[model samples]
Target: MTTASTQVVLSLTERMPTTRRYLMCEPRHFTVEYVINPWMDPTTPVSTELAVAQWTAMKETYESLGHTVETIEPVDGLPDMVFSANSGTVIDGRVLGARFRAPQRSAEADLYRRWFLDAGYRDVTMPSRVNEAEGDLAWTGQILLAGTGYRTDPAAHAEAQEALGVPVVSLQLVDPRYYHLDVALVVLTEATPTRQAHIAYYPEAFSPGTQRVLARLFPDAILATDADAACLGLNAVSDGRNVVIAQESTHLIAELRAHGYTPHPVDISELRKSGGGPKCCTMELRG
Candidate 1:
């Protein structure tokens, strides 16, 4: 790992020229109320107060760094609403809505749509197939990396490409633990004209074919260990330079610093019990 004094640290503006905007939700009624994914276990208890405090801290962190942060009202019986990244994908000033696989989260589709429309996202694209939106789809600065074989259907990738007018690369997720693409992959920066950015991901979470695809596309990408993946460390949010991640993911943080990226660790342990961290609670609003 690179030592603090020797590390090359880039300011947010130098790394990302555009102001990063995000949408988040308050953990007002957040809980493991239903078991929709492997991470959720309703039998376990959840501290709503702690979840709120952690989420508020995350929002403030973004604002403190000169980024824009917006909020969506949390609805009752929608515990997973706190994970706003699943709501939809915003690209090129358009919102591509999500079609949740589970009925427990199906209502979220409409809730997100209403917010998008009211927020002046007139070019909203609704999907005919099942898609979890940004939860499985993320921009790598050059292309859209879409995940399937779990929460999002393979067909949704085609729809996303058409709706967003961008090239889409489909990667198959084999591990149930990393059900969402965002859980296994962390895009370091969007590709710019002068430079190609990189990503950090857990190869074990993907199928062999998808792993090979990633290895081929990103030969110099960072690889997360099983321990780090289990801590949901790969599920991170980066503004090209500074990365906000789970405080417990020390190894990953060291790796990021070694790669000249500053890691901002936050204690979202309460939210991690529900299988989420900084990235899960944040949805980059490109539109």
Candidate 2:
């Protein structure tokens, strides 16, 4: 109903400029090496060549828009390493390392920590609790919107809040299909004093209480259609102006465009076999 928050979201899509910087990992060695998520089935065949080609196309898409695409060296045996967004999240020049729930991904934490350290990020906090970094926790301006009940532990929310000096809102994920918060919720615009934040999410991913909380907090949020949600529509990467989303999420693409956003759809179907999408493959280096 034409609320102030709705107005802010509309203004954001109309006025916010594109972000020029991003960090990604080439899927050169990407494959469904193991079953870490609901989508990943070790028995099913995966094409590593196709995954790499699609990822390269995505990187080139960003570069064509005049954005800087920095990459991390892919380590052998870490198939999920291609999902760079799960590594860690950066805020205020400080990095918070992800403590993965699975052993396969836990070792990735150390590599990401080392990378951040070498990259000159001094205040890197190695989390003790099980948190998949940006996959579970995302920053809407300074406030953290965290998800739990699948990969990230609820206690880690407090730890992140203490480390980042920001308020953290914990949302409980109920569906295993949308394990990570980034897969269920997409932060479209950051909150500020004069403008409200905007987000898009699949309601079925969260518990009833969490759904109520989300509805109350973001009354203007775009509720994703069931078909779009199944296609991992919420797993989209937005640069405030341009939103790179999954090609199969047709409903979501139309929804974003109706809200004045420029939707850049890309085919990452090969990587989706491992439960990773466009947002999963990209991480924004917030300074």
Candidate 3:
């Protein structure tokens, strides 16, 4: 007999791949210089050289898969700049810039805001409330799924809605290890005119209410295993069909395949020392 999850997978139609534009920053200065999230540890040694090599390979993988990859220059002192997903949220050509919660990452907000303005984004709005941009905000093609209870202030949810002109659904993350919504949930197939949205998430990362909300929103959503979640497997980037994920997430990779999605695993273990994975390094540029 097929499991409920497997049955859900079998019931789904074929998935289609779309070419996406992504913004990535090279891990030139990536290191565990400070500890913020549970994954970070300053005492542990980090290899900047290895980080760069791994990041380069991930970027190349996106390009090889018919996606456009753009880069932003990395600043020396900001080691976490490599995880550009925290920079801002972009949708329909409008940009809502991030306001970091941690003082160490405060400077990144202005830099990313400047990049948006420089790129000719006239509808850019710098958020006043503490919001980590795409790190806590995810666009599901139908609505903005916002996360709080950790990095992003709940007040920012309304602010994001106003700035981006979209409906926002707020979810509270309970686990510090899954502080960011992107770390706990990955949108598998964004809602389109012909299809509803689909996602894969780690239920334990969310509060009970949030888990129930997620289930109601995505009844057929793939539930990730504990081992995969521990490896930051839910921190993935999906272009409707192909999923770029961490190489360490073996079970999640198999689940993606079973669900008719291609999983491209990249080893960013060095960057994971600072609490980031494939999705953390990629910022989608939607227009």
Candidate 4:
């Protein structure tokens, strides 16, 4: 039952793995002390040891995949610091530090800023607007896809664009559960000279107009099921070919394979108590 259209589609799905550099933080003091997102419940008991173990496994996974993984020192009392992807958005060696919207996480921004500066990143700029960095901003190689209506302010979209010199497309999130853009959308293949960029996202997480915009922009984008999205499947990190995702997201894993992606599943259940998955714990250092 092979069709001409299916053959063409399969032929066009040429995927190649690219070596990536990533920044991560060990969940040494990780815990859900307060509620910032719907996924966080302070009442639920958390295990710091379990979080560390899971994080270590994830770090190893990236290393085994031929990617460079860098770590940042975690400050005490900032349990959520483990979600290092929110530290900032780094593009072409230019660093745009995060400005947290929540008071509980405000202190984290400066710590991350200092890290970037001390790490020899001379072009680091701390944003004035309330932006949670990679939590709401996703770089698709060609343009930046930014999410607003939750943790990040729409105004930060312009700030990011000006700072990074990349065109930014603002997508409005309507669901609090999918508060950050990373929780709802993942850039699968970043656009290059020969291929168009591809993404996988949950339509329900975005507003009607925003959903339409996504559809128009990525007609071949994979759509996540409700069950997959609930497990933070969209909160994944893809190196063009290999996608590091939550093991609980079985459906998304299957879909990723159908699309010619090799999905590497990791158990970050302990960290998910604080609303983070693989992508939340790993920030890509693009240059």
Point to the candidate with the largest lDDT.
4
Clashes of each: 2, 0, 0, 0
Q: Give me the runs in candidate 2 sitting further than 4 Å from their true place.
A: 1-13
lDDT of 4 by residue, 1-287 (tens): 98977865784478888999999999999989898889999899999999999999999999999999989999899999989899899999999999998899999899988888888999998888999999999998899999999889899999999999999999999999999999999999999887899999999999999999999999999999999999999999999999999999999999888788899999978989999999999988887
- The residue-by-residue lDDT of candidate 1 on 105-162, one tens digit each, is 8998899899998998899998999999888998987899999988899999999999
Candidate 3 local distance difference test against the native: 0.92
Instruction: Give the range where candidate 3 is weakest over 10 consecutive residues by summed lDDT.
Output: 5-14
True-structure RMSD, every candidate: 2.7, 2.7, 2.3, 1.7
- TM for every model, in the order presented, reads 0.94, 0.94, 0.96, 0.96
Of the candidates shown, which would achieve the greatest TM-score relative to the real structure?
A: 4
Measured with C-alpha atoms, the lDDT of residue 44 in candidate 3 is: 94
Stretches of model 1 off by over 4 angstroms after superposition: 1-18
lDDT of 2 at 151: 95
lDDT of 1 at 173: 95
Worst 10-residue stretch by lDDT in candidate 2? 11-20
lDDT of prediction 2: 0.86
